[model samples]
Target chain A: MKNKGLLLVVSAPSGCGKGTILGEILKDDSFYYSISATTRAPREGEQDGVNYHFITKEEFEQRIAQGGMLEYAQYCGNYYGTPKKEVEQMRDAGRDVILEIEVEGAMKVRALCPDAVFLFIAPPSVEELRRRLNKRGTEAAEVIEERVSQAARELSYADRYDYIIVNGELEKAIQDFRTVVRAEKLRTKNGNKIDEVLNHA
Target chain B: MKNKGLLLVVSAPSGCGKGTILGEILKDDSFYYSISATTRAPREGEQDGVNYHFITKEEFEQRIAQGGMLEYAQYCGNYYGTPKKEVEQMRDAGRDVILEIEVEGAMKVRALCPDAVFLFIAPPSVEELRRRLNKRGTEAAEVIEERVSQAARELSYADRYDYIIVNGELEKAIQDFRTVVRAEKLRTKNGNKIDEVLNHA
Candidate 1:
């Protein structure tokens, strides 16, 4: 039987370095990034299946009806959910799977997959988070204010996470993430090396 | 009511740099290193209460009889145990308590303190561990062999640890240890700063 890969759940405030770190983590061969399925219209230059599995609302509803989605939620009048097939296939192939979801979705996924490692990525401070959001220069003042407020709310649940990674330094944060992944691999349930030693010795 | 500090259980093989990492960790103002009471004669240059609480067999037995020690173990013809009073007082003062104990004593501490964070420090490879053991230049070849064998055996229980820190690089291992500490401090049961916000807000 093939060994199953670890399920990693990552949550962060909007402006935190989750995307950047997740992108770096994707470079590792042993990890498979779980592509989300959504009913929202695909943004410019975004691929239909690569960036997201962009489907019509009816198609999304059908998947929800058939229990194909692992966790689904309606956000901004659009449906978003994690597809079960790809994640299961990757895990069965002995490749770790990563889920980048909001805090609320991460909590739901935790209930569904209690074995997954829940990581909360936070900026060094709330002021730093605001600075990053302001530097983005994509939203208006009102929108930025709303985002800052939501960020405060998201951070309030940081204690519920199994691990908290501070995004103060990119290289340090990346190293810590790598350490967590390596340590997780050595886990009894996940590491075959441990089993091999036990069975032989 | 005062907040209880997290009880940190640190365990490692004989030559895994556990002592060095722990020494640095103890220097942090937020951490209080537990002074173990021993029933052995103090070595030259070793302070009575600073390096260890050197007590007579009678005093040790009396403390044991009075239910004062957290966990006691007989090793190499000497009894060593963590003093309960100092650890409790440090915890009451909101300083995290660090226990540097062997695997057996670590397991005992875990049973007594279920919320404690158990971390296992490990060398990169068995060969490296041997090199470190030999480099000490204080133990005989046969004794070093015995220690390596014991380390191999201890490593078999790595699965029991909450986190494994590989001492490949000193700074990296220190950072990883600190990351785990920061994360544990953010846990809901210990301080629950995050929970307090979400509920109150």
Candidate 2:
């Protein structure tokens, strides 16, 4: 296979700072973090096409039917899917793309893009996760409990991941993530580049 | 399942530096690198139980019959196998042990130690591997040709490994090997040390 950019699929429970990591990776010169398409309504101050390619339900379904969606799913009655064109374009143009999704969506993307690297982000433990959720202080006690319980269940699927990052220390976690990205690039796909460097030297 | 040490099984073609990397790892102070017991006559300057545990053919067969050998194979009319008791003792003492064996022997060890990490080292390409083999200089041209042909057949089994490392660059390959070791240790054995590191912080 020719040397090309990578597709990084990241999944994490709610409040695990997947968004924050995504934002940081976008600032990296080596990556082009993708904006997904969603039928869900945008929150205040979110922009169309920038934050997400917001569209009507009919439009979303039409794109799916036309095979424009790489992976898509419905959650709480709202549809979300990754656009196939932009991600492929960025990779072909030599920029790796990041796809941050839920575990279910990550599995979907894995089926669609078998070469994509799968990463699972986890908190320290159920107790630490609950502490983080409680510290948010923006949700009701019942809602916090529900989210914590959901996180606990989701963690059971962590063994399925190629790499699991414990998101307790930001610096260390980011370093580990970057190491995985770099090391994966040196696999068979771009491994020749290193050889070329050595041969010329 | 307890926080016990792991048996790591690594295999590769002769020039892939499996021996060198395994030797570097033995210096970690927390690992016990397994020495094979063999029935082959020792070469000059070779030490018993250090270079190899030289034994008589009759003694080697006795160990195999008694199930004392973790993995054994006869190559060129000589017996070689890893001793089970020493490995178990090292692991029970919480010291990781590495077994650097050829592919055939690795398969046997995997059957005996199911939880062991099985890694295969590959060169960037068959052509590059041939060049390295030729550079060794001790081998006759016919022998080099035979080894290269053997390496080509071995490449087909690369997928049998849990992780594949292409030894195109020495330092990078070493780093990749270190990453696998560190990441494997992070796996939750019984106490989940990675989780504890996250939680306590």
Candidate 3:
């Protein structure tokens, strides 16, 4: 019997290095990254399905009406959400799917699929987080302060997650994330292949 | 803050290669093996506290009355059980303690320490298990048959375990066991070191 894929919901506060850790993990082709469906126009050199599933506003609204969107949010008059069908299909095909989102979106996914493994990535320290945000130089000082406060609030929810990995070092953090996926596959619920092998023998 | 050691309850049917797997894992010196206190006389070269904690029957009974034994059983007029204080001390010192027991003892540990990680190791197939038992050449034919039947009954309880590892290849089985321990330590309830670092920073 083929093993079913695991749905992993990864959440982290801003500047917690979740993106870097995920980028390293996705370098291996074993995982299927869940692409977000957006009403925004595709950028230059971005493929429709590879980067984001570009959809019309009317189509996005229709998907929401039909309950096709797992979770969605409107930002700058554009709809961004995860398509439930694609995720389900990938999982059914025995391909592990990773959905990287913020705390609120992760909460939504938790409601939709309670069995999904929820992991919260955290920075080694709040001071370190503040340093990373400042190093990015993408936001103004006031915006960075707001992000730091927002991160503290998000960290409060870390206890609700199934696993918490502190991004102290890049390589160690990536390895820890991979370990979570590997160990979860060995759970009794997912390791039923043993039964089939034994019975057939 | 130091991370607390994990209590690991490992169970496997006879001839499942759990002994071999654990031998390889303990060679690293990272784990403290839980020594069993026994009323039986120690064989030559079996030092106290190293092999078995040789104790008098009266002492064993007193410990049992005091609830010092994590789990105990009687066979051939001898008492054999785990000493809870030693296991707790090892874990409190950030050293993982492994309790290698049979299915019934594992169930007892589960009731006493629900937070401990319970792992069930299985053979690749029933045929493979029978082959391994025969290869040992220590048991009579009738005894081997009894062991095989017992193994079948024990396999039924694998689903009750938190993790099940099929001991197909020796190296792979050891790797899976280590992965379970590593992943369990990262669980949010035990990963409080993250909180200390964040707060102090």
Candidate 4:
């Protein structure tokens, strides 16, 4: 049966290796990873449209005002959001669109698209999460403690997502993610296609 | 995270290659293929408790009256049904159980165990179904035509299933069956395991 593509909302706490897992998943051409239009300045070697859809504060607020942003949040005095039109367009064209966002934004997207697949990547344990964060060596001990607390809060919301992949091993997590995509596509087919076989009779 | 095993309720119209697909699936030791109980006389080369639990009419009626049968159907003046106790025992032991029942029996299991995964196997087309039914060359033209009509009726119920696999290529259909099993196991995890991580803190 022919059906529209999936809208996938993915969330993971800061130190859960979500970026690496998602980066591996996006290598497939069938997925159109939703690029957030942000007011943040592009970092060195980051291309506009490829890394982030760089936009002015005026345009960011204007899109939010016009309801063109699917979900947006103000972080570090910068606006970041998924463009509503692009995500819908990609799905309409039978292309899966992945939205990588934090928990609050994911909840917002859930309300807007009830059928969207919600995926949460989780570390094996809170201690493991702290170890990963500390190993990064980019945060002070106090900052790491704060992040661990924030991560506990995020992990609390893991129950609400449709599927949770405990990232114990990288390869298994990637394979599990692909299994979800295949199973969801099979689940989401339009029932009206029962007519296809009946018509052939 | 610890969780109970899944009870998978599978239904497919005759000639849709359901037995072949399920035979491939049951090769994995993690699954306990459900053997039904019947009052009918055993066919050639059939063994008790292997092919089915062949019981007397009195015993079958006793089980039904005691609510021991999960779902039962009367066919050709004999009784056939799924024995409820063994299925529950296997599932409680963390072993996935497969119930390969027909459409009506599948619905009864659905009402009894609402969380049981429902899978429907479908052919590529009704014409293909007719072709496969006729290919057996054992039935008469009238019987074959009746079977095709019966198949169409069963296909109408395919929409009620949680997932549908259109068996076009044999290998791909088997792979899809495995995919659904993996994805469903991922989906059916108990959320209370979030404490596993939080407790480490």
Q: Is the docking of candidate 4 incorrect, acceptable, medium or high quality?
A: acceptable
Candidate 1, B46-98: lDDT as tens digits: 99889999999999999999989999998899999999999989998989999
- The fnat scores of all predictions, in order, read 0.13, 0.05, 0.54, 0.47
For every model shown, the clashing-pair count is 0, 0, 0, 0
Worst 10 residues of 3 chain A by lDDT: A191-200
Cα lDDT tens digits, model 4, B1-201, are 446678989888899899999888888988999999999999999999999999999999999999999999999999999999999899888788999999999999889987788888888888998888888999998998998899889988888888888888899999988898888777625332455434464
Full-model lDDT for every candidate: 0.82, 0.78, 0.88, 0.86
DockQ of all candidate complexes: 0.18, 0.17, 0.51, 0.42
Question: If both were scored by TM-score, which would come out higher, candidate 1 or candidate 3?
Answer: 3
Candidate 4 runs further than 4 Å off: A40-47, A56-62, A188-201, B188-193, B196-201
Model 2 stretches astray by more than 4 angstroms: A1-7, A85-96, A107-116, A133-146, A182-201, B1-6, B15-17, B66-68, B88-94, B107-115, B122-164, B186-201
> Candidate 2, which CAPRI tier?
incorrect
Clashes of 4: 0
- lDDT (tens digit, per residue) of candidate 2 on A1-201: 345788988888887877776677678877987888999999999999898999999999999999999999888999888999999998888788888877778877777777888778888667777788899899999999999888767776666667778887777778777777766664544343433322222
Q: Order of all candidates by lDDT, from best down to worst?
A: 3, 4, 1, 2
Q: lDDT of model 3 at residue A62?
A: 98
Error of 3 at A184 (Å): 0.8
Q: Across residues B164-186, which tens digit of lDDT does each residue of candidate 3 receive?
A: 89889888999999998899888
Residue A108 CA error for candidate 1 (Å)? 1.7
- When only chain A is evaluated, what TM-score does every model earn? 0.91, 0.89, 0.91, 0.91
DockQ of candidate 1 compared with the true complex: 0.18
